[model samples]
Target: MKDKLFKNLLHNAKGYSVLNSGGQLVKGYKPDTVLQKGNEYIIMECDTGTSRKGYLGAMLKAARFLSNEKKGVLVLVIKEKPNTKVKQIAEHLQEYLIWLQPLTNLNIVYLIESNRYCPDENPLELLSSEFITTATIIKSD
Candidate 1:
Protein backbone atom coordinates (compact mmCIF):
# COMPACT_ATOMS: atom_id res chain seq x y z
CA MET A 1 0.00 0.00 0.00
CA LYS A 2 2.68 2.46 1.05
CA ASP A 3 4.93 1.60 -1.85
CA LYS A 4 2.25 2.02 -4.49
CA LEU A 5 1.10 5.28 -2.95
CA PHE A 6 4.56 6.77 -3.08
CA LYS A 7 5.16 5.39 -6.56
CA ASN A 8 2.08 7.15 -7.86
CA LEU A 9 3.10 10.39 -6.20
CA LEU A 10 6.57 10.30 -7.72
CA HIS A 11 5.10 9.47 -11.13
CA ASN A 12 3.01 12.64 -10.97
CA ALA A 13 5.86 15.10 -10.29
CA LYS A 14 5.90 18.14 -12.59
CA GLY A 15 8.51 20.16 -14.50
CA TYR A 16 10.96 17.30 -14.33
CA SER A 17 11.43 14.20 -16.41
CA VAL A 18 11.04 11.44 -13.84
CA LEU A 19 12.51 8.10 -14.87
CA ASN A 20 11.13 5.07 -13.08
CA SER A 21 14.19 2.93 -12.83
CA GLY A 22 12.99 0.96 -9.84
CA GLY A 23 11.82 -1.84 -12.11
CA GLN A 24 15.14 -3.51 -11.25
CA LEU A 25 15.93 -4.16 -14.90
CA VAL A 26 19.56 -3.78 -13.85
CA LYS A 27 21.37 -5.43 -11.01
CA GLY A 28 22.77 -3.88 -7.80
CA TYR A 29 21.65 -0.24 -8.29
CA LYS A 30 18.14 0.78 -9.15
CA PRO A 31 16.75 4.05 -7.82
CA ASP A 32 13.08 4.98 -7.75
CA THR A 33 13.47 7.78 -10.24
CA VAL A 34 16.01 10.03 -11.93
CA LEU A 35 14.98 13.66 -12.27
CA GLN A 36 16.43 16.05 -14.81
CA LYS A 37 16.03 19.76 -14.08
CA GLY A 38 17.96 22.03 -16.40
CA ASN A 39 21.62 21.11 -15.92
CA GLU A 40 20.90 19.03 -12.87
CA TYR A 41 20.38 15.28 -12.58
CA ILE A 42 18.68 14.25 -9.38
CA ILE A 43 18.67 10.57 -8.45
CA MET A 44 15.63 10.09 -6.30
CA GLU A 45 16.02 7.05 -4.05
CA CYS A 46 12.83 6.21 -2.25
CA ASP A 47 13.34 3.62 0.44
CA THR A 48 11.34 1.85 3.10
CA GLY A 49 14.39 0.99 5.12
CA THR A 50 16.45 3.64 6.89
CA SER A 51 19.77 1.81 7.10
CA ARG A 52 20.75 0.82 3.63
CA LYS A 53 24.33 1.95 3.42
CA GLY A 54 25.21 -0.48 0.63
CA TYR A 55 22.39 0.86 -1.52
CA LEU A 56 23.27 4.43 -0.65
CA GLY A 57 26.90 3.85 -1.59
CA ALA A 58 25.91 2.66 -5.04
CA MET A 59 23.65 5.68 -5.54
CA LEU A 60 26.44 7.97 -4.41
CA LYS A 61 28.76 6.53 -7.02
CA ALA A 62 26.13 7.08 -9.72
CA ALA A 63 25.59 10.63 -8.47
CA ARG A 64 29.34 11.28 -8.62
CA PHE A 65 29.58 10.24 -12.23
CA LEU A 66 26.43 12.13 -13.18
CA SER A 67 27.70 15.22 -11.40
CA ASN A 68 30.81 15.24 -13.52
CA GLU A 69 28.64 15.52 -16.58
CA LYS A 70 26.02 17.79 -15.00
CA LYS A 71 24.96 19.17 -11.62
CA GLY A 72 23.73 16.46 -9.18
CA VAL A 73 21.32 16.20 -6.34
CA LEU A 74 20.56 12.96 -4.47
CA VAL A 75 17.01 13.44 -3.29
CA LEU A 76 16.39 10.66 -0.77
CA VAL A 77 12.72 10.39 0.01
CA ILE A 78 11.99 8.07 2.91
CA LYS A 79 8.38 6.89 3.15
CA GLU A 80 7.80 7.12 6.84
CA LYS A 81 7.49 9.76 9.50
CA PRO A 82 10.44 10.86 11.66
CA ASN A 83 11.86 8.23 13.96
CA THR A 84 15.18 7.44 15.58
CA LYS A 85 16.15 5.14 12.72
CA VAL A 86 15.16 7.66 10.09
CA LYS A 87 16.95 10.44 11.97
CA GLN A 88 20.11 8.40 12.01
CA ILE A 89 19.79 7.74 8.31
CA ALA A 90 19.23 11.42 7.63
CA GLU A 91 22.35 12.31 9.62
CA HIS A 92 24.39 9.76 7.73
CA LEU A 93 23.06 11.14 4.47
CA GLN A 94 24.08 14.65 5.53
CA GLU A 95 27.56 13.47 6.40
CA TYR A 96 27.87 11.89 2.98
CA LEU A 97 26.50 15.07 1.41
CA ILE A 98 29.17 17.16 3.11
CA TRP A 99 31.86 14.78 1.97
CA LEU A 100 30.52 14.42 -1.56
CA GLN A 101 29.55 18.05 -2.28
CA PRO A 102 33.12 19.28 -2.58
CA LEU A 103 34.10 16.17 -4.49
CA THR A 104 31.06 16.26 -6.80
CA ASN A 105 30.75 20.07 -6.91
CA LEU A 106 27.01 19.69 -6.41
CA ASN A 107 24.80 22.64 -5.55
CA ILE A 108 22.80 20.99 -2.74
CA VAL A 109 21.58 17.69 -1.31
CA TYR A 110 17.99 17.19 -0.17
CA LEU A 111 16.47 14.61 2.23
CA ILE A 112 12.71 14.84 2.29
CA GLU A 113 10.35 12.74 4.39
CA SER A 114 7.12 11.65 2.72
CA ASN A 115 4.88 12.96 5.48
CA ARG A 116 5.59 16.56 4.55
CA TYR A 117 3.69 16.37 1.27
CA CYS A 118 0.03 15.97 0.50
CA PRO A 119 -0.78 12.94 -1.66
CA ASP A 120 -2.11 15.41 -4.23
CA GLU A 121 1.12 17.45 -4.27
CA ASN A 122 3.64 16.92 -7.00
CA PRO A 123 6.88 15.42 -5.68
CA LEU A 124 8.93 17.62 -7.98
CA GLU A 125 7.51 20.64 -6.25
CA LEU A 126 9.17 19.50 -3.04
CA LEU A 127 12.49 18.89 -4.81
CA SER A 128 12.30 22.23 -6.63
CA SER A 129 11.64 24.05 -3.39
CA GLU A 130 14.94 22.85 -2.01
CA PHE A 131 16.89 23.43 -5.21
CA ILE A 132 15.32 26.82 -5.85
CA THR A 133 16.01 27.97 -2.29
CA THR A 134 19.57 26.70 -2.50
CA ALA A 135 20.13 28.31 -5.86
CA THR A 136 18.92 31.61 -4.54
CA ILE A 137 21.28 31.46 -1.61
CA ILE A 138 24.16 30.34 -3.81
CA LYS A 139 23.53 33.09 -6.34
CA SER A 140 23.47 35.74 -3.63
CA ASP A 141 26.89 34.61 -2.56
Candidate 2:
Protein backbone atom coordinates (compact mmCIF):
# COMPACT_ATOMS: atom_id res chain seq x y z
CA MET A 1 0.00 0.00 0.00
CA LYS A 2 2.68 2.45 0.98
CA ASP A 3 4.87 1.78 -2.00
CA LYS A 4 2.01 1.56 -4.48
CA LEU A 5 0.33 4.72 -3.25
CA PHE A 6 3.56 6.71 -3.16
CA LYS A 7 4.56 5.40 -6.55
CA ASN A 8 1.31 6.82 -7.98
CA LEU A 9 0.16 3.30 -8.80
CA LEU A 10 -3.03 3.96 -6.85
CA HIS A 11 -3.70 6.81 -9.22
CA ASN A 12 -2.67 5.06 -12.42
CA ALA A 13 -3.09 1.39 -11.49
CA LYS A 14 0.36 0.65 -12.81
CA GLY A 15 2.29 -2.51 -12.13
CA TYR A 16 5.06 -2.37 -9.52
CA SER A 17 7.79 -4.61 -8.14
CA VAL A 18 9.01 -4.39 -4.58
CA LEU A 19 12.78 -4.83 -4.54
CA ASN A 20 15.04 -5.14 -1.55
CA SER A 21 18.57 -3.94 -0.89
CA GLY A 22 19.60 -7.55 -1.15
CA GLY A 23 17.69 -7.69 -4.46
CA GLN A 24 14.70 -9.39 -2.89
CA LEU A 25 11.51 -8.10 -1.30
CA VAL A 26 9.91 -9.96 1.57
CA LYS A 27 7.42 -12.79 1.09
CA GLY A 28 10.36 -15.00 0.23
CA TYR A 29 11.61 -12.83 -2.63
CA LYS A 30 8.12 -12.90 -4.09
CA PRO A 31 6.21 -9.91 -5.45
CA ASP A 32 3.47 -8.08 -3.68
CA THR A 33 -0.21 -7.91 -4.65
CA VAL A 34 -1.16 -7.27 -8.23
CA LEU A 35 -2.33 -3.76 -9.04
CA GLN A 36 -6.02 -3.09 -9.39
CA LYS A 37 -7.70 0.18 -10.16
CA GLY A 38 -10.05 1.55 -7.48
CA ASN A 39 -9.25 -1.27 -5.07
CA GLU A 40 -7.24 -0.47 -2.01
CA TYR A 41 -3.71 -1.73 -2.24
CA ILE A 42 -4.46 -2.16 1.42
CA ILE A 43 -7.87 -1.96 3.04
CA MET A 44 -6.79 -1.71 6.67
CA GLU A 45 -3.32 -0.15 6.93
CA CYS A 46 -4.64 3.31 7.76
CA ASP A 47 -6.88 2.23 10.59
CA THR A 48 -6.13 3.70 14.02
CA GLY A 49 -4.81 0.44 15.35
CA THR A 50 -3.39 -2.83 14.03
CA SER A 51 -1.31 -2.16 10.94
CA ARG A 52 -0.93 1.59 11.15
CA LYS A 53 2.54 1.04 12.57
CA GLY A 54 3.19 -1.46 9.84
CA TYR A 55 3.40 1.63 7.68
CA LEU A 56 6.17 3.43 9.61
CA GLY A 57 9.04 1.48 8.08
CA ALA A 58 7.24 1.25 4.78
CA MET A 59 6.40 4.93 4.84
CA LEU A 60 10.03 5.85 5.28
CA LYS A 61 11.01 3.66 2.36
CA ALA A 62 8.15 4.94 0.25
CA ALA A 63 8.91 8.51 1.17
CA ARG A 64 12.50 8.09 0.10
CA PHE A 65 11.45 6.66 -3.24
CA LEU A 66 8.80 9.34 -3.73
CA SER A 67 11.18 12.10 -2.86
CA ASN A 68 13.49 10.80 -5.52
CA GLU A 69 10.51 10.84 -7.88
CA LYS A 70 9.44 14.29 -6.61
CA LYS A 71 5.91 13.27 -5.55
CA GLY A 72 4.62 15.38 -2.70
CA VAL A 73 0.92 14.65 -2.55
CA LEU A 74 0.40 11.78 -0.15
CA VAL A 75 -3.32 11.09 0.05
CA LEU A 76 -5.30 8.68 2.18
CA VAL A 77 -8.80 7.89 0.99
CA ILE A 78 -10.97 7.67 4.07
CA LYS A 79 -14.69 7.11 4.69
CA GLU A 80 -15.35 10.61 6.21
CA LYS A 81 -14.88 12.89 9.20
CA PRO A 82 -15.54 12.81 12.93
CA ASN A 83 -13.59 9.70 12.21
CA THR A 84 -11.38 9.95 15.21
CA LYS A 85 -9.71 6.85 13.88
CA VAL A 86 -8.63 8.47 10.64
CA LYS A 87 -7.64 11.68 12.35
CA GLN A 88 -5.53 9.89 14.92
CA ILE A 89 -3.81 7.78 12.35
CA ALA A 90 -3.17 10.78 10.14
CA GLU A 91 -1.57 12.73 12.98
CA HIS A 92 0.49 9.79 14.11
CA LEU A 93 1.74 8.98 10.65
CA GLN A 94 2.42 12.61 9.88
CA GLU A 95 4.58 12.96 12.96
CA TYR A 96 6.27 9.64 12.49
CA LEU A 97 7.06 10.34 8.86
CA ILE A 98 8.36 13.77 9.75
CA TRP A 99 10.73 12.46 12.36
CA LEU A 100 11.67 9.33 10.48
CA GLN A 101 12.09 10.91 7.08
CA PRO A 102 12.52 14.58 7.89
CA LEU A 103 13.68 15.39 4.39
CA THR A 104 10.60 14.01 2.69
CA ASN A 105 8.77 16.61 0.65
CA LEU A 106 5.13 15.71 0.82
CA ASN A 107 1.74 16.54 2.29
CA ILE A 108 -0.85 14.06 3.54
CA VAL A 109 -4.63 14.17 3.32
CA TYR A 110 -7.29 12.07 4.99
CA LEU A 111 -10.02 12.01 2.37
CA ILE A 112 -13.49 11.12 3.59
CA GLU A 113 -16.54 9.48 2.09
CA SER A 114 -19.88 8.09 3.18
CA ASN A 115 -18.93 4.85 1.50
CA ARG A 116 -16.34 2.36 2.61
CA TYR A 117 -14.43 2.97 -0.60
CA CYS A 118 -14.58 5.00 -3.76
CA PRO A 119 -17.91 4.63 -5.56
CA ASP A 120 -19.09 5.25 -9.07
CA GLU A 121 -20.57 8.70 -8.49
CA ASN A 122 -17.14 10.22 -7.83
CA PRO A 123 -13.62 8.99 -8.18
CA LEU A 124 -10.35 10.50 -7.09
CA GLU A 125 -9.45 13.39 -9.30
CA LEU A 126 -6.04 13.53 -10.92
CA LEU A 127 -6.00 17.24 -11.74
CA SER A 128 -6.29 18.55 -8.23
CA SER A 129 -3.05 19.99 -6.78
CA GLU A 130 -4.38 20.86 -3.37
CA PHE A 131 -3.19 18.50 -0.69
CA ILE A 132 -6.23 18.24 1.53
CA THR A 133 -9.28 19.06 -0.53
CA THR A 134 -12.54 17.49 0.62
CA ALA A 135 -14.33 15.34 -1.93
CA THR A 136 -17.77 13.81 -1.92
CA ILE A 137 -17.41 10.09 -2.44
CA ILE A 138 -20.94 8.80 -2.00
CA LYS A 139 -24.49 9.74 -2.87
CA SER A 140 -26.90 10.71 -0.14
CA ASP A 141 -29.41 8.09 0.88
Per-residue lDDT, model 1, residue 35, is 63
Winner by TM-score:
1
Query: How many pairs in model 1 have backbone atoms within 3 A of each other, for residues 3 or more apart or on separate chains, i.e. clashes?
Result: 0
Tens-digit lDDT track of model 2 for 1-141: 233442333333234222222222333332222222231221112222235564454455445434444543333444333534455555557666556455654434233432433344443443244322443221111
> Which stretches in model 1 have alpha-carbon errors above 4 Å?
10-15, 23-28, 52-55, 81-87, 120-124, 130-141
How does residue 51 of candidate 1 score in lDDT? 57
lDDT of 1: 0.54
- lDDT of each candidate versus the true structure: 0.54, 0.36
